[model samples]
Target: MSVKKTKVHLISGFLGTGKTTALKSLMAQKDPNEKWVIIVNEFGEIGIDGAVLSDNGIPVAEIAGGCLCCTAGPQLGNTVQKMLRDAKPDRLMIEASGLAHAASVIDELKVKPLSEELEIAAVFTVVDPRQFVSPDYAQQALYKDQIGVCDVLVASKTDLCTPEVMAEFHEQAAKLFPPKAKVVEVQNARLDIQWLDIPVIEKPRYRLKAEVLPDNTMGFQSEGFTFPAGQDFDGERLTHFFNDLPKMTEGLVRAKGVFQVLGTWVWLNWVDGQWGANQVSWRRDSRFELIAKSFDADLIEQKLKEALE
Candidate 1:
């Protein structure tokens, strides 16, 4: 008698592209009777996405401080093995770090023991249309490689893009050699659950590079800071602090933090010159992370400290 293998799906995307949001949307539409587990990987030391996703009342395993395809490869394999043994979930969904190499991760899952217990399902890569048209994101080798490995190309945050940006996104997506299985535009990361059932097609044309590069090869540095649960931040002052970071700290590209503000907790996101925040129910210690081409650590710390109440 043979046991049924667990279905595995990969969610790949670049930094700050709303991959977590898409995962949440999918979870909402999942079968109520089936057991599902999630594995979230992050480039930062602190696991913000994992913590946020845990609010859904599901088991979520987080691998942080490195890319799952490289520095965290051993950890990724170990986590998968343990999850299979302990949880025995009917389905497993992995949200790879924005900087992760999808091909490398897929290779890891195909190893002997793991390959026997898990079957790769459709892979989805989420793209922000605004970044799709920007040279800063479009010209990067990692960005193109991410799109190259996807079975589905998800254009997220389309509601925020202009007509020109949307047109360019559609044009570029259509030009890919081995075309994507499906290309979709979604708002707030709402993905249709039916897409998850799409069968995986093997593409011999898509090959992984012999040498795997470290996450830092992209010239980005990341730092994560945590504060005690009792620590409180002045919401107004914190807003000003984050708003000034891009100008105050050179090379600042992405920054996100969950802070205790007054009697509530708020989640703040800063990316590509845009800032957004929302109230949330997280009760964990206040924490934040910053990713930049390069920046002064001491200066950033000092400014953040000044925002404390």
Candidate 2:
């Protein structure tokens, strides 16, 4: 009997570590004819990564509101089955929530139905180099667990860090990471496509496991709004509104959406205290998704309505 196999790349990182950016880079290097499927698990209810990849015409499956390793495990299994049955993808990549522990995901994939079909290529964990030098890096168990589970260590956002910091990061990486893992550094999360083909030996699973909804994700939440067609947002007004959102909404972390602006469409993203808007293809509905620790959704909706009016 012949067994069917699909290569799997599990990408893990914390919030704002640039897993999506890495996916974009990797996708650009893909052969046009090859089919790749992405399963994005997000901690917040509003899924931003899925939207971004979908915009680029990539097939994406999103699991939102909690970590796939915990709350969305069943959904992950179901999604995998559907993707294999319908999409018949050449490869599969899972972008785990920043707050998740990859060991659970790996163990999940190892079990029947998925295990019989999947050939895990490598486990890649992206890290911000700046975090290596921070005292909090050692203190945060989630971060430690994320790193401990990966077969490949990816240092992302290297372009923004200093040479001294990079050197220090390498020093720390040598000591803390699994001896067999390969380390690579990238700016803007742009990793080499060849790295995906490098086969890896699976590490032992983590013994300590948390419930599907981990404590770290308790403070995170999301809200979304949809505007009907032709009820376009004013571009200038929208920019100002997003700029003022962090100040107006307590615990505001990120806000993003594709909006019909002045008869055209644009993608707006407010993240990590900065905002950017770029022109994108048209979508039927103009919608916004917000992620925050705890914010008043009514106030946000009212403020946006006022801006449009």
TM-score of each: 0.64, 0.63
- Count steric clashes of candidate 2: 1
Report the C-alpha displacement of residue 149, candidate 2, in angstroms. Answer: 1.3
Q: What digit string (tens of lDDT, one per residue) describes model 2 on residues 60-158?
A: 999999998888888989999999888888899899999887767876786788878987777788999898568888567678667766767899888
**Tens digits of lDDT, candidate 1, 151-245:** 78999988899999999998888755334568999988889999998755433122212122126567766666667545789988998998788
lDDT of candidate model 2 versus the reference: 0.76
In each prediction, how many residue pairs overlap at the backbone (N, C-alpha, C within less than 3 A)? 0, 1
Relative to the unseen true structure, what is the C-alpha lDDT of residue 302 in candidate 1, on a scale of 0 to 100?
80
RMSD of each: 17.7, 18.4
How much is the lDDT of residue 178 in candidate 1?
Answer: 39
Candidate number with greatest TM-score:
1
TM-score of model 2 (CA atoms): 0.63
Worst 10 residues of 1 by lDDT: 204-213
List runs of model 2 lying over 4 Å from the truth: 202-309
What 10-residue stretch in candidate 2 is worst by lDDT?
204-213
